[model samples]
Target: MNQQAEEILKFYERQGKPAGQEEILGALQELQQVLGCIPKEVQEETAKRLGVKPSFLSAFIKKYPGFKEVSAVHEIHVCTGPSCGSKDALKILRALEQESAQKERKEGISVKIVKGRCTRRCAKGPNIKVNGELCHHMTPEQAADLIRRL
Candidate 1:
């Protein structure tokens, strides 16, 4: 049995029936959870289920950050905003990226390091977020430790 798919379906059910665009977004996000990145077949199927146009789905996927065309098992986003950048954010990014490579071979962990404009905690400067958990006052050692333990 496809337990993950079933779980995703259950989540969709709890989300209620989306009438328009909201429904389309909700369904796509759920499918992304199950399928990693939505394939063409899944996109078409979702459009048919939601009674929305394929173009509409395409636009949403293009615009929304949550909808990814490529999926990663782990993602680390580093803030490159003025405050964080001034506080050695790039060093943290490099450290994490390097650690990701080493761990990727050792444990088969797929990591993607992304640069973000801001995480909205300027006072925290040198901020980063792993998956979705925000970290404040980042350092290379801290970043390396976080990714290594994964």
Candidate 2:
């Protein structure tokens, strides 16, 4: 385990119960600042130490924007549900993922791409949410361009 994971385990052990969402969020924020993204192993260890299932931690990471790992500037989320899929959502998603990976390799910082179910903008079809802003009717190329600009 990494030093951060060790520290988290020790802290939780001292506390005598599972860490709450706020505590986990705070730890995750610190971890992201120190280590970029939360490593899968660290997340698992954190879940174990807190006595919560890994799925719970995963769910928390998905639900809370603060827990997301991204550069200080922005984060990206794409809708991949049935409605969005009709608009070549998978292609858009792949483009964004590739863009994020390229940025990470070049800049040594991470960008997040979260896939979510309907943002209730089914009318919008393929929609994307960037830094909490909703974008409608995006093509794969457009999504890639948007990430480049960000």
Candidate 3:
């Protein structure tokens, strides 16, 4: 085990078995502080040390909203499948990126864009979901407008 993993394991053992989400988050934050981003291997080791399933750790990480808030990163999920992409999804993404860049300068919001496949909304082709809200038939200009409004 690496030094970070060892430290995490020692911390977990000291805290006893079945640690809560807050404790897990605290450990993850500590690990990140010590070693930057949490590596998958370290996550697995941390899960093992805490006597929790790897999936449990992963789910916790996914559900933890603290990272984005603390890191000043805003996540935008854009669908880029045959349907959405064909409908100018790239244009929408570019527009959103530009808008985000402007917002970052004025409002200080750091936006991170993620391209998603399908999103199971092909029927709504040209669809984009901002933080999970499905916005269908969105043009590039509309997408830029939407991000600014958000």
Candidate 4:
């Protein structure tokens, strides 16, 4: 097996052969961290090693913003729920889009920005997730700055 897959299996085993999806999610996060993305082969190897059903893993990947099938330099998710909308989440989204576009033109950085569903953290509205890491209480300028830094 490849080193990344080996590391993911080792991490899963270190977590004590956990059967719960939450525990498995932790291992997947580690995989994302080490590999920078969770492609199909890695996902299948993970499922096989960890006794997780492929369908469950597939569903989990789709349901969570943190997991992605395709690789990219960064994936930014802007929360567009009612609470975040009230907090100008759309503005943050636009800022990211514009900044990412500018960077792609100038620096050739690849970024994918998507509108996300309610994260249910309404109190911490206007949240954006960058490469699976959540950032809270964002503004247009801050979001744009984040993209520039990336």
Candidate 5:
């Protein structure tokens, strides 16, 4: 087992009980909290340790917000809420989508682009999240520059 698998198993073992739905969920949540995303191999190892089917965890993770099965090299989320919309957030989203496509084709780097709702930072309209880190006051040119830099 790799270090990540061992660390995750250790967390489960510390619970000192047969892994139930709650315990497994807690473990997965902890993994996401610490690693930002739960890797496929880690998820499989976790399922094995919990004595449950891999699909169960896979489906469960998908249903929950803020949990990802795999971490992309770059994940961009452009807020499309009313506040952001008024600030041209969609334009930035489009720019990032185009730039990501071009970058992937030229350099083979994987990027995931998502349209996100308000992050409750209306004062900072036109917000974008790059790899889960927030950037406020974003413009299409800035978004394109970010993709190129990444």
Candidate 6:
């Protein structure tokens, strides 16, 4: 087993019960939390533990939002809700994308950008999240600045 799989199995072992078939989603989530991206071997082992085929677990990752094939050093999500969209959130997103050097990053900082919906802080329109850190009332310049730092 890989180091990440050992750590993930330890999480389930702590519960004093095997992760049931129904808990595959939970186990997959735990794996993602620990390893950033789920490895093929981890999926195979998880399928074995859940008494399912590896293909089934792959389907879950394909359809699930929390699962990812690749890990990013930083994630930037821009709000595109009614309020944020009205306040030029798209402009900020564009600026951040242009500044991130997404195509080729020799620096190894993989910055992922997403156009997200209401951040719950709708009143704080034009908000963006940098590596899960919420920045409210943002501007293109401010968003660009944050992206550059990544």
Tens-place lDDT per residue, model 2, 29-123, is 66666666665566776788777788888888778765553344467888988899888999999999988676654433466788975788999
The per-prediction tally of clashing pairs is: 1, 0, 0, 0, 0, 0
lDDT of 6 by residue, 11-116 (tens): 6655444455447777778777766677666667766666667787789888988787555568888999888999998899888888776421323246778897
Could you give the C-alpha RMSD of every candidate to the true structure, in order shown? Answer: 11.5, 10.2, 11.8, 13.0, 10.6, 11.1
| lDDT tens digits by residue: candidate 1, 1-150 | 146745654555555444366666666777777666765555555555555677777788889977765444798889988889889988998999899886664444678899975999999878888889999988999999999887
On TM-score, the stronger of 4 and 6 is: 4
Relative to the true structure, candidate 3 reaches a TM of: 0.50
- Candidate 1: lDDT of 98? 92
Total backbone collisions, model 2: 0
User: Candidate 4 residues 28-145, lDDT tens each?
Assistant: 8887776666766677777777777878887888889977765546888889988899999988988899998866644436689989667777898799888989898899999999
lDDT, candidates in the order shown: 0.74, 0.75, 0.73, 0.78, 0.80, 0.73
Error of 1 at 1 (Å): 31
TM-score quality measure for candidate 6: 0.49
Clashes of 1: 1
Q: In model 2, what are the clashing residue pairs, if there are any?
A: none
lDDT of 2: 0.75
Each prediction's TM-score versus the true structure: 0.52, 0.51, 0.50, 0.52, 0.52, 0.49
lDDT of 4 at 18: 34
